[model samples]
Target chain A: MTSGYKDLSITVEFRGGAELLFEKKKNELNLPGDEEWTLRRLLFWIRDNLLKDRPELFLLGDTVRPGILVLVNDEDWELLGQGEYKLKPRDTVLFISTLHGG
Target chain B: MCSVNDAEFETDDELMQPDEVPQTEGAICKKCNENNAEVVLRVKDTYCSTCFLAASTHKFRATIGKSKLVRPTDSILIGHSGKAGSTVLLHLIKAGMSEAVHKRLMYKTTVLYVDDGAVLGQTVDQRKSTISAIREQVHGLGFTGYAVSLNESLHSSEPKIYPLDEEAEDLKGDSDVVDLFNAVSSYTSKEELLHKLRQKLLISVARSLGCCKVFTADGATDLAITILSNIALGRGAQLPLDVGFVDSRELDIKILRPMRDFTRKELIYYLNFHKLETIQTPGLTTKKEPYTSIQKLTEKFVTELNTEFSGTVSAIFRTGEKLSIGNLEASNLIETCALCRAQLDTVFTNTSSLQATEFSKLISAEGPKGNIGKAAFELKKFPCVIDAAENVPLRDSKNCDNCSCSKGKEKFEMSAKNFEKYLCYGCRLIFKDLDKQHSIPDFLQNSVRQRISLDDMREEIADFLL
Candidate 1:
């Protein structure tokens, strides 16, 4: 899949029960760097590749689900551009599910 | 990135959208006005780490202080579920107790974790590991820790609590717990049953430990969902007790939800800022579809609305705070439901929903021409109805003529019809979903029997009373 371009290494972390859908708590992935990447694209990619079950839970329409909080480098994705925020190399993206019961 | 342009760029449209987090790269803390703000809470309220922590700690302390319910030297139990809100609650309690002598909390603290892994379908090893992790967290905080399984609620006697330092024995009657849940018809009823059983277990454990007050970590968002779901479940009468800061439903034991002021977002922020790790505890509807249960559907609704409006949860919570049931005088054990223990809301007027439901059932059971008068007569026979009658003196066991206290016990056949009268409106709905073949928990059965015996005693003295 990565024939033309270098690989963009990044980390994806899940907490607050979001990991249950992904089957693991954290993942390190290398995406093909041929095309410009945004969080919207990253979500679809994660849903296709990493999500093992319940894609509806991790993604709603074209973005991440409402109950799931997305953080980019420890900042709220809302402060960033949400789905429109461009993903850079080595950026740490985290998804935390607030729907879990206390 | 320029501060001058950023200030000029603020518009009414941006101000109206409280759900959106504006650029905080150069924004100063709203509280301290010194350091650059790191967190944006309640929409535009920005705070630095130090200010946010201080404010949160102050809120926690203030909640407890304003209540004046906890006394110095009193032992209180903290119900920890290992979720993010509870993890932060534990951290806050630890920090409070370790503060300076003048400001430190004086109440002794213990932690209790009721593992519902059986109902959540966790394997034995998985349950053990979860409990072990909780044990480590509790011990690391220098507090006494106790663990119990959700199945223990089925036992008549007090639940067996295993110390965190010691190995927990295999819980007997696990099948009974599983059977009880399996018998429930829907996910909504299953969740409600789980909640009630957990609550009963908590109260029983607190009573055994001689702790009068229990701390639960239900945040604003949680309480908001609970408020809506409780109403939908026909528990509107007990809304005050259900979502209040202090739940005195048991009278002797009080359930305090001090974290009711904080949102889930704040809790996650607190944990992240402090680098505290939380265990992911799966609940009944954890991986289920969003609309599988009433509670889950309400949760999804509340959370999604809160995401779009930010103030949605607190608005619901504040509205719930203002609710108070006027007739709390009948809050004694006998006047409460035999199951969930909320004050019995079974008594209804002629035009009430309860009557409408009973009429519908009568028509379905015995044709449209069924004896309505007979059904009304049967409804009036309920103890809650008798208690609600005006000018009737309260009947006590001592006033009975042919008291059964000294006689041999009678075999109690707890039928669904008889059991329905002892439950509140909400519990009646849950009971309706229960399978007839399976017996109820011993605690509930015993309570109902006591109520029945008391009623029998009242009937024996009916002729003598005015």
Candidate 2:
């Protein structure tokens, strides 16, 4: 299989106003499955494919913005090895924004 | 929504991985020995989900219980934003009032939602819809709900109607709302105005509702961000009243923050654990650039520091709590601020201390790149006098009421007579860039008029009083 061929399918959800960046609260994306897909790689994928207007609100430099919280498969991403946790097929990744005004 | 073709952000570092996972294997729940700990909190307490929730609720109750700021007889108005932190607070309060809990807080509760949607230039319909939705949510929680637009403070003298008329362009008048919209000139000033206006509106609403106490929902992380931001904005003098849990700035209507002990992570966990629903409230920068304002920048900074440094927020908050108001000037001065009502500092005092201060200012003016250097040199030629001896004519004195400065041209002599004076130092900073004096809110103008009348009476009866 070619390394660029889409393989891994996952669910992505945004809440707590993080959806303001994604244009929608939830989406299903097919990640390139030819190699190991890390959370860091997924961010690059999301920024390139998913994020819409004002991407700075969602991603600062390489990772999600400071106030945006990332969770993977119902566990705090911090517990699952943050952005390094290798993504598995059908995994659910969530981003919640704490930056929005309360 | 724009297409992905227009993606503006390019990932700068694609090689970065998730941070190295620390050694958390051996840790177990300190509270409940049966379950393994999932979350480690500040003060180094590890807890299971159930234990963590219990501990959080305990802390919330304890914080309020210890501070005798709120009494059973006092009508309490909670300033809720319907977000995660506030959702957790409201849920906890509801649970506390339930018959299942001990020592139920039977005090009458009211939720005041100051719809700041207008700050983002949301249209009248959009803002009204948001307010109505919030009202429904507030009522659903079984609390007395009162809603107001943030722009109402500008025309506080009148009863403001929400969902403003179609012809009513921008808060119904040439109020400071327009100024705030145009005054996006500086991030610091815009944030300052928003905060001050919100506080002013909250206080007014609380008073009108006959509520004795107002509960703000500033969490530990939020307070930490606010502390640093206040310092950066030169509001160090008001730190105690600004960030303290019990802000007794207004003696009659005290503001308290019971959630000051909880962090954002804890609050989010609490909300998720309880399955409580929260409404998304768009803030000033909901659509604008994130780093445009000091408030936004501070939020970004604090959150980033929090990710790498776990206990940084609590440490900052504890330090802020230790700040004392003892060194501050008297809290209850007669000539208080007309805007936010804090005690005004005396600008033109006739004491020896003022003279010593003047001498030091003169020396500082000659220092390299001194802010007052040009002003001092220019005042020498004009009728203006700098460092004049005692008892100069009022017109010749260079004291400007706009600022507490003894250097600027006397504002009364200038054409800027309409600019409000008697504002506290912090409020003056807020008005620094707001040069459109006519747009100054009626709340401030009315207060100024009241103070003027009071001063007139005092001046007329001065000879007989002594």
| i-RMSD values for every candidate model | 2.5, 2.8
Model 1 lDDT per residue over B296-343, tens place: 999989988877798899899999999998764653434789878888
Indicate the residue-level lDDT of B440 in model 2.
59
Over the true interface, candidate 1 deviates by an RMSD, in Å, of 2.5
lDDT string for model 2 (B51-73, tens) is: 98899889999999999767876
List of clashing residue pairs for candidate 2: A84-B18
- Per-residue error for B332 in candidate 1, Å, reads 9.9
For model 1, the DockQ equals 0.46
In model 2, how large is the Cα lDDT of residue B360?
Answer: 66
Against the true structure, whose DockQ is highest? 1
Strongest candidate by TM-score: 1
TM-score against native, each model? 0.87, 0.79
Q: How closely does chain A match the true chain A in each prediction, as TM-score? A: 0.90, 0.87
